[model samples]
Target: MRALGGLWDTTRGMTVLRDAGYTPNEKHVRRTYRRLAEAGLLTKVQDRPVQYRVESGAV
Candidate 1:
């Protein structure tokens, strides 16, 4: 969650997490993103590749 918190304004992609020190694979992050989206704690932006942002005040 620290990673997400620190990236509040940035649209985070799986690759960003990997580059930012997350140890898990991209698939793991993708799954977690999906769950968060379903829970309404995050929003997924569709584009060339999907990206995510934590909901405002969700933390």
Candidate 2:
């Protein structure tokens, strides 16, 4: 999640994560975000391309 901190949303987050040397399967990344959202640690803002914001204090 620290890798995702400065990113605008998940697509950028994944790109940054990859660039930072973290490699999870694409489906796993998406699923992890979904789980985070369900747990209220993240909030989905848009569906097209799937954008999300980490909840306040989530870090």
Q: Best candidate, TM-score-wise?
A: 2
CA lDDT, candidate 2, residue 53: 77
Best of the candidates, lDDT: 2
Each model's backbone clash number: 0, 0
Candidate 1 yields a Cα-based lDDT of 0.64
Which stretches in model 1 have alpha-carbon errors above 4 Å?
A: 1-22
> How much is the lDDT of residue 48 in candidate 2?
80
lDDT for position 32 in model 1: 79
lDDT of 2 by residue, 1-59 (tens): 64445434556656767998997566777887888899888888888878777777775
Residue by residue across 1-59, what tens digits does model 1's lDDT show? 63445332223455566687876666676787788889988777654466666777675
Local accuracy by lDDT, each model: 0.64, 0.73
State TM-scores per candidate: 0.59, 0.66
RMSD of each: 4.4, 2.7
Which segments of model 2 are wrong by more than 4 Å? 2-10
